[model samples]
Target: MSIALPQLKSIKIDKFILSLFSAIIIAFLFPTGAGMLHLKQVTEIGIGFIFFFYGLKLSFTEVAQGLKNYKLHVLIQLSTFVLFPLILLGLKSFLIGLIGETFWIGLFFLAALPSTVSSSVVMVSLAKGNVPSAIFNASISGLIGAFVTPLWIGIIVSQSGGMSLGDVFLKLIIQILLPLVIGLLLNKKLGHIAKKNSSKIALYDKTIIVLIVYASFCTSILAHMFDGISFLNFVFLFSAVFCLFWLVIGIIYFISLKLNLSLADRITATFCGTKKSLVHASAMVNIIFANNVSASLFLLPVMLYHITQIVILAIVANRIGKRTLNEAA
Candidate 1:
């Protein structure tokens, strides 16, 4: 006799994405109390733990194996740190007019950030791609971005009389790099516990991210930093973010073909190279632009792009996975 099986339903919306928007909305309606609660200190401590857990879970063996694919690594890193920012720089004169100077800076901040570690690896694995390389690129991208992102932002912030470049680096070393190093040092003893409870850790991370978002928006809302922005401007911003995603995807696909990359490597490169980490963006914004009341403005593109990449890549990854399965059959 044949047996009936349950079919899985596709997820149309991510709960975490909804939570992000909700955080913004809550901040809008109730913009007070974040400061009174000392959320800055809370988020700062949370950011340290987030990176600590990130380092704890990172496997040295996987990183070593991923290093074998030097060409692929170089391609992904260059696309992330160089090509993305250069494209934005080239378009700055035109885009800055449309989005306004402040919002344009936000987009540049998004461009300068690193790949999302969890989603990149998950998508690559889903599409039957180079999982190890995705993990390596995603991890290393964040580390590289800790230095590189600030340099990119420094160019703009320096002009505006924001934090000095030296101060930025000093803060990053204390807040981000130091915690990461400590976690790595303890990895040999505590890595397994981190791996075992990764889901819980991820939930903790997301909670902290939501808290950061809420806190930032609260500050901005109270300051009326968004008063000048209009509905039309938001439409334009979303359109620009969408176009940026596909533009980078197209460029990466073309380059992958020209480089004669394997199907798996192509998938890894495209996915990893196009993604930007909201986690890193949230953490860095607080540290890098700490004194700026309009710091939440910088998160706009990062949040929008985070949603865009997740929704679009989920569909694309599933389609590619099905195609690979059919070909194997």
Candidate 2:
């Protein structure tokens, strides 16, 4: 008997999406939990674990071999680290009064972030896209962003009080680079095992992200972070984030078509190129914005963009998968 393939399900409202709202609600209702849990320390350790496992799962050999398609890689990297920021920067004058300066800074930070590792690969696989390329690009994007994000921010923000670029780099080294190096060194023996248990690792990744969201939002709530902002401001912020996501997706699709890429590569480029990493955003904010009262405001746009991209792309990926299956059959 032939083995049957797994059935693909259409996207719908799901618990994962609901959990995002739940995270915000819980944080708002019980701001004290953040302190009781010592979330700051937990988040620090969790951030390290996130990168460590990421390094463990990454195979440098596979990443190197996959880089043969230099054009696709370049397009994706530029879209993520360069073009996205430029677009926001171009619109900065228009956005300041509309969304206020603080939210604008948050939006800028969101654009500067790298493409996500887990969700990008998941979306590509679901769409029956270029899995290897997605994996390679997502993994490498983080490494590039670890340095590039701060450099971009430094040009725009001279200083956040006493926190300087030097301090940011120092924290990056201790928190991100050192742990990543340790994991990479450990990868020689542990890579295969980590790869084998990827599903479990993904669950771990999401759990840590949720914890970070709760902690960050809780702290913001305790400080009455959103009290000053009106409901209209949030509505406008959501709209801006929604527009940004679609605009990037459209650009990636058009560029892939222009370059005459393969279907798989096109899907990979569209999905991976358009993503911004919530993991990096959550981890980096604690270091970069250090002790800034408006830290939660910086996270607002990121959370909105992350949620929007996931929901929209999941539906798009499902449709693509169904069409591909029908074409094959």
- What tens-digit string does per-residue lDDT give for candidate 1 at 281-310? 999999888878889998988999999999
- Residues 149-245 of candidate 2 have per-residue lDDT tens digits of 9878877877554358898999999999988988899998999999999889877777777777788788777788888899999999999999888
Alpha-carbon shift of residue 322 in model 2 (angstroms): 2.2
User: Candidate 1 regions off by >4 Å?
Assistant: 1-9
> In model 2, where is the ten-residue run with the lowest total lDDT?
4-13
List runs of model 2 lying over 4 Å from the truth: 1-9, 159-162
Considering only N, C-alpha and C atoms within 3 Å, which residue pairs clash in candidate 2? Answer: none
Candidate number with greatest TM-score:
1
Which pairs of residues clash in candidate 1, taking residues 3 or more apart in a chain or in different chains? Answer: none
